[model samples]
Target: MVKDQLTQIYTQNELSCMATYSIKAVYHKLMGEQSAVTWDKIVWNRLSIPKHRFILWLAMQSKLQTTAKLAQYGISQSDMCLICADAKEDHKHLFFACSYSKECLKQFKEWTSITSASTDLQQLIRNIQNGRRSKFQKQILLVGLAALVYLVWNSRNSSYWQQSIPSVNYVVKHLKAHTKARIWAVLPKKLSTKDYQWFNEL
Candidate 1:
């Protein structure tokens, strides 16, 4: 049923790929040799992950990291969404199209003046490589995104293991901090501590 709905929503080729197997297999099979590695590929590889596992891992990481009330270390389906409190914990709501994440993207676009392609993860990856940003800027953004993803994952682990709520502000702060450490130089500061705190309180 879900596959049929996805097929109707997307093109035949997209439907076929999305339905054939796991998203990772689809990504590797179709995207492995696309000539140009997109922002998604760059970000995924930066995390030292294989292509297919990266997709699922990223999505899961985003949600699991933010949730503070779930048990510290077990795989279960009872976790609740930390942001909206209206849904179960899941990947889709944690990353691309979540309401809170959308707000975060909105702030990102306004600050960077870089328009994201779409809320769809696949499209984000596809469009990021082809966007009009400079190579330097693209690399910076890619690194920032990668850091943010990893930080979010780490924050989730902290919440689960340490019984602490890792706020979005901490996530963003750690992202900037780690990015700076990695780049080893001063870069333009995009998001602020106030912004991070506000996002957490939202």
Candidate 2:
């Protein structure tokens, strides 16, 4: 099938003469194009840690292997949440719906002054993307949210493997310190003075 497609392309392009062999043109012709997703910016933000971005990518697609997913495959014995133990351990419950994750998000919001009232992960990301904050502030919020998601998932894994979860305080503290340090390390050269001051104040 691939050979037939290549033969068609060659014949259509009339490669009998001196034809320029552009790999990019051939690749694009073969692969075609795909529409961009709304969360692309949130997941691929330059300010976010690479590992955090990877986890957020999986999470935005609901691809994380939570207990509920494991249970679907007869891998886990129960679908109960490992962190909260009061709900099914799916992507939604493990994000901000769980008590442990809720406190972490609340503290993060209080620290960052994020006013969005949404608890759903995707909705919160959309709020940040469309909020009336400065570009730098939006980037910070998105990166911080990604870090929170990564840490929350990490805490859930800790509970599953070690039978203990990190405290909410611990998670929030780690989130603040790690995210702040990460942004500080990669501060953009074009950052406005006001945004720099605001970041320093945070």
Candidate 3:
């Protein structure tokens, strides 16, 4: 119906329809789309997953990478991590397991006053969503998490393409810049204490 027609249009030009159909699909639910929370935008942009496929993939992967399965993509099964050459390339390593990422999370926890379990991606998202915080706080956390994921993935690509290593601070800095631009453009006001602190340090 309207959703299908809008989806077709969205596929053709995301920016042109940003104000009309996309925003409406998000905040207004003109079609059979889900309600837009900050998490919705965070997840959509960060993962690059289609809206319809996100939940299904979450159910399957729980946010952790199954090395055995993903190995078909040319990444070694034993190569558990692409960032920290020392760690296994799994969800924890990518997000919380690596030294740099661990440090970043430490700052994040201190700033946000939120704690996350050493779980897979799906669990982490759930933890952030169920957090006892304001909608604004929740959106910030989602943005951070999304930024972290996207940064790690890009770092992996860098490692492979350039045959070089990336520092923890480097990835953190990149994520901060990217997230800052996107969040500032779409949302009102400056970042919170935690996000601002991280951005400043970056």
Candidate 4:
């Protein structure tokens, strides 16, 4: 049956078939592979919150309303970060380099044992989702990383627009609370006791 299907798939003359295959091969080859960091594989599926997923998607694209982006649109008068007030506010700096954000992220890293989260957005994600980790550990790390991004963006917005950002303690408290709640409510039911124990370690 497979042989018949293959024969039908190449029913045309060899010259025509080869030309057709060559065109498709050339097109894909010309397109090549992207080496840029992509958060897509773990960003959508298995995420517990739609809002968190959306923010993470925007973050991966560097589309958030950091001062640099606002300036690019001719809206922002000051380039200083609303959260940190010292460095220019771009997606990369606002997300991880700001002192305020760094402190908050530090607490989260300590909580989850991911100490190498970088200020570079792509590298930060790579640190969390590398090949050397276990499946359950990777899941925990991805979720924790998303929670950090969401919380960072949220706190930045609050400070930028509302004249207040939650204390670092509050931000960490809320992330752990909301994430733990989501895990219980939405994570796969097949997780074993050891998985549960590992999650607790995070």
Candidate 5:
């Protein structure tokens, strides 16, 4: 079967008799090419914490096991948000729509000076990317946003298992610390004086 598949691909590409074998060519032909997503840089930013990036990636894809998803799978009986306890718990509400999360987002925006009015995760990312902020500023904002998502998800889990949710201020404080430290550790050497000063004030 493998030999037959290889022959099919070879014929489809109309390879010359002298063409060299390429694993890359074979792989792309087998799996097809995927288009790039706009959130790729936001979720995979180099300055963001690895675990935070991972959670952001999952949250961006709506794959986090929120109570709404759990209820749909019969693993949970309650779909109410653990943090707010007033709405269905899902990726959308857990990120910023819930009162607790909205407060956290408000604090984050104040810190980063992100002027976009969006509370939705994906839309906010698009806004940041398209905004007029400098590259460094945008990176800092993305890092902070990623940290918020991670902490908010953690708050939800705590509410579930520990029967406690962290205050929005507590989450925001940690989010600022984590994002600041992460950016400082990998800070680019060529940052402009203006950007550096802005970061220092944050």
Candidate 6:
């Protein structure tokens, strides 16, 4: 290695990849390539709010405490979901497979006119990757995914401690109103009237 460098080589060293390359860039590149399914865009998206992003972070880490996890940790013996009070609560079921969660996600999709092509969380996040969609469409879908996960978790905890759960319609209403407010804040004047109409209908 020393033989290949200049006379001053003994005085200094440098990253060998490229002059402009960075460790952060390499880390992100490696992360993007290592996954069996595409996940970088799913959680790294900027359209979602900070709190929602935090929820996705926990979810990807498998850190959210589903009843099944609690049981495995000896924290609780019951594995049933507090929301549905039927199926055992595991990460997969709590996020997507549970009937109650499915209902919430379904309403969110219907209200947003997204009609997600996949039912499960991972597949749904991947389905939104179609590059043909408008940029705003993609952004909104990503934000919607984050919002649904956060909403389901929030409602579950609320039901657990409050002894009551919000109706699916109520949750959907709140989601729409929140999305509408966010839309106005983000919509740029460069977007055409038609684009504005599309968001309004969403």
Which one is best on TM-score?
A: 5
The TM-scores of all predictions, comma-separated, are 0.51, 0.83, 0.55, 0.78, 0.84, 0.76
Model 1, stretches more than 4 Å misplaced?
A: 1-41, 44-79, 82-84, 185-202
Arranged by lDDT with the best first, the candidates are: 5, 2, 4, 6, 3, 1
Q: Which of candidates 1 and 6 reaches a greater lDDT?
A: 6
Taken over the whole model, the C-alpha lDDT of each candidate is 0.52, 0.90, 0.58, 0.77, 0.90, 0.74
Clashing pairs in 2: none
Q: Which stretches of candidate 4 lie above 4 Å from their native place?
A: 1-37
Candidate 4, residue 126: Cα displacement in angstroms equals 1.3
Better of 3 and 5 by lDDT: 5
Candidate ordering by TM-score (highest first): 5, 2, 4, 6, 3, 1
Where is the poorest 10-residue window by lDDT in model 2? 9-18
The residue-by-residue lDDT of candidate 4 on 25-60, one tens digit each, is 545545677586466877874744778878888888
Q: State the lDDT of candidate 6 residue by residue for 80-147, as single tens digits.
A: 89899888887788778888888888887776666665667777776777645777777777777787
User: Which parts of model 2 are misplaced by more than 4 Å?
Assistant: 1-36
Model 1 residue pairs with clashes: 24-52, 65-156
How good is model 2 by TM-score? 0.83
lDDT of 5 by residue, 90-171 (tens): 9989988999999899989888877888899999999988898899999898899999999999999999899998888899
For model 5, the superposed segments whose C-alpha errors exceed 4 Å read 1-35
Q: Global CA lDDT of candidate 1, please?
A: 0.52
Residue 178 error for model 3, in Å? Answer: 2.4
On TM-score, the stronger of 2 and 3 is 2
Instruction: Tally clashing residue pairs in candidate 1.
Output: 2
- Candidate no. 3 TM-score: 0.55
- Point out the worst 10-residue segment of candidate 3 by lDDT: 47-56
